[model samples]
Target chain A: MIIAMASGKGGTGKTTLSVNLAKAFSQPVQLLDCDVEEPNDHLFLGGELLNETIVSVLVPEVDASRCDGCRACSAFCRYNAIIVPGKTALVFPELCHSCGGCIKVCPQNALKEVEQRIGLIRTWRSGGISLLQGQLDVGVASAPPLIRVLKERIEPDRIVILDAPPGTSCPVVTTLRGADLALLVTEPTPFGLHDLTIAVEMVREINLPMAVIVNRMGIGDDRVQRFCQAENIPVIAEIMDDRRIAENYSRGLAAIDHVPGFRAVMIELRDKITALCRKEA
Target chain B: MKIAFSTSGSNLDAPLDSRFGRCASFLIYDLETDQFEIISNLQNLTAAQGAGIQAAETVVRSGAQALITGHCGPKAFKVLSAAGVTVYNAAEGTVHAALNAYKAGQLPPTSSADVEGHWS
Candidate 1:
């Protein structure tokens, strides 16, 4: 079973929930952090680096020595990444999608593909859980491709937990595509409810089974609870507003480790998720 | 000289599109012949990213010697500048007004990109 943790707005506790879930599972769980922009699961679950792999995207490289600049490559590139100006082709790797249309249409054969490093995927093991996270290089615009590379490493047999990025953009959709269940974490405030509505709609649009996890449960109003009830979505769990829990989180310690009896809560959440998945199956 | 202006309509009287990358259309005006043509920029107008760069390349490919638009991002500015295409700030009102402003030397050539990336 694959479970994805997501939040429409940042700082809503997606990472906190994901880390605790991985810890609660007695079976070997594969936790893949798809939030390449800011992966923080490693901080919560400290472990020795088992392996590291460089992730690169194929970007076009122009061979200036070629005889002619027919402008074919430039015209064919929908991205406008290849520019043939004054008898030479200039390639902007950042804009390239690696579609290879420019290379295929180039009559002069002036374009070649080259690997450009965009991010790194590292693997770690802590206790019974195996962690994989993608760290995208700063300034890289294309993250879906790197997220795809990270998803490819998912072990199907084990219970895989994915920590998805915030928002309802392409990256979030990419992470949610094949998820068995999506656990949306949100606060109890008006801003949380507003974004949660969009997030719920996004998940429903993609036709995925999802449940809500209201973090900082008592800080804001009960509007999120009412909205969830009206929408007929289940509230799987709630992490109460506790100052000590926040302090523990800031120190890179999981709630299971710091707060008394929090491990029991996480274990209960794990069982609930497993039961739900079993019911679906 | 051939010049391009980002526009909201197909004709010279069309309103000037404030966005350079995600404009509705581009009006390529030929100063010598006193004629102009319009090309739909619909493809890049909804681009997920790099709309500015794509639009700049489109103007450059149209064989325009200069461009007039409301804003140009850093990447697009570099591409147009390297291709020797002069870029000027967009004029108020219609495309024709911008052309007149260009002819009267009322429009100043931009020394650098007026806006950052993803302005639109």
Candidate 2:
């Protein structure tokens, strides 16, 4: 079964829960960190490097010799990536969506697709878990393509856990696609509840089964729990606000190994996720 | 010579629109014929992105030799420069006044974009 861990707000413990849960699972697990912008799961794993793969996206390259400045390519591009000013076409690779519509529409056949390096996917092994994470190149505006490439490395036989990026944008949706369940990690504050509501709506729009895991459960009011109860969404697990867990996290230590009672919490959470996945299946 | 002025209204009497990319309209005036026409920029005004590049394409395709606006962005400036179209910084007044200033050679030609891209 594939479980995607996501959060509407940043620093809400998506990474924390994902690493701990992966460590708690008894069988071998495949953890994919789909947060290409800033992947930090490797910091906690401290594993040996397995392999690296370069991820690239196709962008348009204009041929100045065969171009007659017909403006057809520019007219067909929705992103305005290609423009014909005078007698040749100019391509802004960063703006190109890699749709290849401009090449199809080019009457002069001046546009060609070329690969541009967008990011890197690195695989590592820590104990029974194999972690693959994508790190997007700086200044790249898009992250979904890299995340898609990372998700393709998911091992079908092993239990997979996807650590998705924050928010309900395209990147998160890309990670959540084709997952058995979406495990939304959030806090108990009003801010968490507000963004969590938006995230729930997004998940519902995609028709995905979802459950909530409330982290830092001691400080804020029970509004998040109440909201989940009202919405018929299950609050599967709650990790209390503990300074020791925070300290272990700061030291790049997995809560399952360092914290005293965190192992039981992760075990229970893993069992609940397994049950939910079974029900979903 | 034909010159384009980014304007808030359709006529030459209207004030110059400071924003070049998302301007309301463009007033194209011919120096020799003393005739002018207004091109609505509504399509680019509501564009999600690349408004500056598209707006520059509009000016270049109009066969205008010069563009008069309050500020230009890097992309738009690059397009205009590639098309050999001179960009003149317009004064804070009506299109008619900017036209007079251009005719008098009072408005200076910009070497580069004064404002960054996506400046609203």
Best-performing candidate as measured by lDDT: 2
Q: Using Cα atoms with residue i matched to residue i, what is each candidate's TM-score against the true structure?
A: 0.85, 0.95
DockQ scores of all models, one per candidate:
0.35, 0.74
**Which number leads on DockQ?**
2
Clashes in candidate 1: how many?
0
Number of backbone clashes in candidate 2: 0
Cand. 2 TM to true fold: 0.95
Residues B25-67 of candidate 2 have per-residue lDDT tens digits of: 8999999999999988889978878898999999998999999
**Model 1: per-residue Cα lDDT over A1-281, one tens digit each:** 99999988888988988998899888999999999998889999988789999999998888889838788887787777877645677788888888988888887787788899999999999999899999999999878999999999888779999999999998899999888998899999999999999999999999988999999978989999999999999998888888887888999998888899889889989988998888776
lDDT of 2 by residue, A1-281 (tens): 99999989888999999999999988999999999999999999999999999999998888889999988999988787889889998887878878989989888888888999999999999999999999999989899989988988888778999999999999999999899899888999999999999999999987899999999989889999999999999999988999888898899989889888889999999999999989988
- Provide the lDDT at A222 for model 2: 96
Over 4 Å off, model 1: A65-76, A83-88, B5-18, B23-44, B89-112
